[model samples]
Target: MNETHRSSTDSSEASHTEDGLSGSFEANEDVEKALLPHMDIKSGPQNIGKETSWLKLCSRWPFLVTFLNISLFIASFTLWLWPAPLRHPFKTQDYWKETSFYSPILERFDIPKISRVTNGTLYDTNPPSVLRQRIGKEADKEWHRIGDHVWPLVIGEADVKQLGKDPRVAVKIPEDLGYGSDAYIAQTEVFHHLHCLDMLRREVSYEHCHQQDISQCLIMTMVTQSTPPTPQTDLKTVVEARTREWHFHIYFLLQSPTETAAALALRDAVLRLRRDGAFVAVPLFRVNEFPIGPHPAGSYEIWVPDSSFSDVFFYLAANRGNLSVLVHPLTSSQRRDHETRNAWMGTPWPIYLDSLPSDGDVPLQYPELGLGWSTSPEQEISLEERLRRGAKVEALLANDPEAAPAPED
Candidate 1:
């Protein structure tokens, strides 16, 4: 009985030992699985959570990790030695921004440039034929333009007020000279220079670095403001009554039904005279304040500085296409001394004026005056002669309606 009991005890002890060994082996297997890199097992409570599949390592030891990485790098280099085909550098906004300095970069392109004359200076680009024709229609003979580019430039004379500060016509502005109070001469000089700008530059296109369309506006405005009275039967008779023969004087010819309007009309007409390259400038002229006799209501006497009279007369005769002109002989001073009483001339004499026309339209002149010049001087053609020439030309053309045609290939 004792022997059987001892055998049972030994069997039970062996079974307990076997069970303990089996449990320890299973626990070791589970631990090994957890430590392997990138294995499908959760690494709870780590900075890189179980979702971090992008980071895969074969070893748990720090040194082992270093060794593994070195091997991996070598393998990568070997793969690169026989590299795959290239791929696009970027696939998203974040990637694209990293590669490029933001698309749509700004850069300036060089282009040819040009300018248009206005107020005696060029401020805009010349237009291709397209723009030039359009602007010309509006300005008549008043503007000239040039181009560095395809743009059209606005051209007009600069005004006195704009001279000093404007990019154009500043040289003519007056500065204080020691001549002191009698600087009226200086004022006169300034006016003369500016008035000379009253004409367009002799048909050329110029250049300006930049542009402003002020001159065109100013010229148009000034024309409305300047005026003198008009209307008389004969411009020659009016001047003859004012001064003796061989004297210097200017004659204005017009027969205005309305005196006030005639004055305004004359003013506008004169301003636009330079629209045609003729009559470059109107010379210094003064209206007669005192008269020799009872002049008609619309008559005016314009005095020329004695010295300038020849210049005035010549300019008129050269440019006169119409009007009956008579010269009275009177010797006068071109310049006056600056004394009030002792001076023989109050001013370089003066042009006389008695009235203005009634109708206030300009560019609208009396057709009786032969040439359409708002200003003067056109080849000595008298009014009657001018009319006669027009009639003759019409008759000749009417007689031969079929004109000659040159041969063309």
Candidate 2:
């Protein structure tokens, strides 16, 4: 209250501050504004808590805040690192994106097809979506066109390379609500490609790991070229402008499920295909690599049969008891006379007989329609002539050089 006391107090505060020991200095309004940190924070109508100090949790427990941030980072990293499947009652956009990884050969077409000899009744609809999920990027909308109630089909690219294996890539799912594998197959047709690309007919079994897996669909691609070549060949030789020694064959397989329910789903799909006049289509492969045999049983050969189709069917049944096709009449037979035209027509896999029977057991000697094979022409050699040349060369090679006539005695 007195002048001496006020002077003493002010002097003492100054001395304490100067000595770096003042904890009770009078903080002025402008003094707070002069702070180096948070100086830019202006006091205005926009600044609701002007002059009020902010107490952050980090200031209380810095380590705990740091641990929480690290946990968030780890969680984010885990989501990015491990691509896992999600379960939703209904499919999501992400589900569509993830399912788009697998694709199909052909998506949409108008022609009716039969999958196997004994699938079931015939109907006109689409195949399931699972098949479209197999081909990956190859089955996108830009590369394919699907018809209503039909399945999506791709306009296959002629990749001289990248044969013999399925390349996994991003595939776009159709935005349409009904877009799926059944619709893809029903609607799609390989523009220039036969059901089969002659890549080789191998039984690439599928295990539907999912609940709706279609393991029973009778899937087959019947490729035929009359002295024509199949695609998917290496350019063995380019004589000139003509593609020579081309390759061709059909592809077929029976995919099933790991669980019995999945198996039934597959069987039902086959029955649907048989009933729908649409042959179930799945991943295709090559015949040479097929485990069944190097040569289709004469009875099994759709091209040249050794016995009645019933015998062939029964024989196939006996050997492949696990392999089941719908044993019923379907619209495919009604719309298309199956056995009359193609021996393997009704079945998912139709066997091909080499054109050059004279050559015996050599599929190479036959003139095949090229599927996805690369080719250049040395000169155009007729298929028959090519066979003759190949046969002569084979005969000469088969001869025993050591058995040549010895010098006459």
What's the lDDT for residue 32 in model 2?
A: 44
Q: lDDT tens string, model 2, 45-161?
A: 234343233345435588787889999999997765442332123234433322222223212212234465533322312663322233444333312332122334432222212
Model 2: how far residue 403 lies from native, Å: 15
User: How far out, in Å, is residue 384 in model 2?
Assistant: 25
TM-score, model 1 to reference: 0.15
Give one digit per residue, the lDDT tens place, for model 1 in 21-126. Answer: 6567655564455444345323343435533543544234677878899999998877654422232232344333333221211112222334645333323346
Clash totals for all candidate models:
42, 81
Q: What are the per-model C-alpha RMSD values against the true structure?
A: 37.3, 26.1
Candidate 2 TM-score over all chains jointly: 0.19
Per-residue error for 409 in candidate 1, Å, reads 69
Cα lDDT, all candidates: 0.35, 0.33
